[model samples]
Target: MDLGIAGKRAVVIGGSQALGLAVCERLAQEGVNLVVFARDAARLEEARAHIRRIREVRVDVVAGDITSEADVDRLAQVTSETGGAQILVLNTPRPPSPMRDFLDETDNERWRQAYENQLHGALLVLRKVTPLLIGPGWGRVVAITSASIKQPMPRHAVSTIFRAGVQAALKHLSMELAAHGVTVNSVAPATVITPTFRPPFHNVEERVRAVPLKRGGRPEELSALVAFLASDLAGFITGENIQLDGGQTRALY
Candidate 1:
């Protein structure tokens, strides 16, 4: 099916590897022009090359952390280069430390940094890039979050808390932007075999014990949903926390 997004420009944050890279590749496959954002110059280039090989789409690389105001500001301008971006995929590959117990979270600075790295950072990008979409009256914002946003993970204190905050913001943004033809939503993905989850999933036996599917969710699985969400097919869906868990979560709502 044609997603009705051919030639549209998109910016995928932290899109150098794992789900981010996968999303970029899917967008390219759909004939969408992409600009991958990352803090590591090398990783961004690697993603750029990989996407170029996957399809003949214009893939630009932007190097910067999402947590920085200056970086987001720069990205906003970068979007203008491709006639203003129509899609934004906010992805953070490296989540903060897993502080299971309240006592483990000893420093206030740690909390501040955690929120800044994930929540505040993405919010800045949203602020800077909204104008590009509003002017054209069409846009897609898909946040790559974790399953903890719906079902709290034992050790993920900071990520769970802030991702829920982002989900709430996306809900509000959906309502605020609905009239303008912009959609705001999130994808709370399940377990994936990647460097990002190695630490959390160190105890492999313990981790998959609850997964009814008896397997881990792949990065591509999450990216496929993201690509759909960014496309016209998902036009009616917004303000939702769509889970990509492998039946790890049992909540029906």
Candidate 2:
């Protein structure tokens, strides 16, 4: 199944490891050149080598936190140099560890940080990259969000709040950019196995029991959907938040 995106360039945020890296590998396999962005310099280098092994596509890495405008500016600069990217995958940041109850999370600062990390940071990336994509008259923007936005978990309130905001923004952008041949959509996953779920973050066994599939989703599984959304095949799909939760989320819509 040729995705018809070979030779196109992509900017993958949080592409250093786990689901993000999986997306990077999938895109590389499709013959897409990559600009892998994340905060870890060493891990980014490792991901670059790993993707290169998958195929001979150009894999560049930029180390910086998405919440920092300076870092995103640097990413935009790099992307501009080699021609604008046709695809933008914004992998939402990992939720804070030791998930807290809504009432127990009394620290206002924590809420602010959540907004900064998820919503504000997403806007920053979108602002810097959308223009690059707009002029091309062909673009794909896929935001990797959380299923929690649809089925809110008490312990994961912070993540749900900001990610929902990101979803709203994507919905609006879908129509705003439709005339430019750009599609904006989101993929929400829950109980997905990723490096971000290390100890102190989530209990894998406990969470899987709630999923009808009785298992956590694999990174590659989620990446496959992302690859589809970023391809020409998904051009008609926009303003939607598709869930890859293994029947975990019961929302009818």
- List of clashing residue pairs for candidate 1: none
Q: Give the TM-score of candidate 1.
A: 0.94
- Model 1 worst lDDT run, 10 consecutive residues: 93-102
Query: For candidate 1, lDDT tens digit of each residue in 1-253?
Result: 8888889988898889878888888899899999888999998888898899999899888898889899889988877875778898888544566555555777788789889987898788778876677856778989888888778877678777887777787788889999889998888877765555665535656676667888877777888899999998898888887888887876877
Q: Candidate 2 has what TM-score?
A: 0.98
Tens digit per residue, CA lDDT, model 2, 127-222: 897778887689999999999989998789888888888998998899899999999999999888887765678887888888999988999999
- Give the count of colliding residue pairs in each prediction: 0, 0
Model 1 regions lying over 4 Å from their true place: 200-202
Q: Best by TM-score, which number?
A: 2
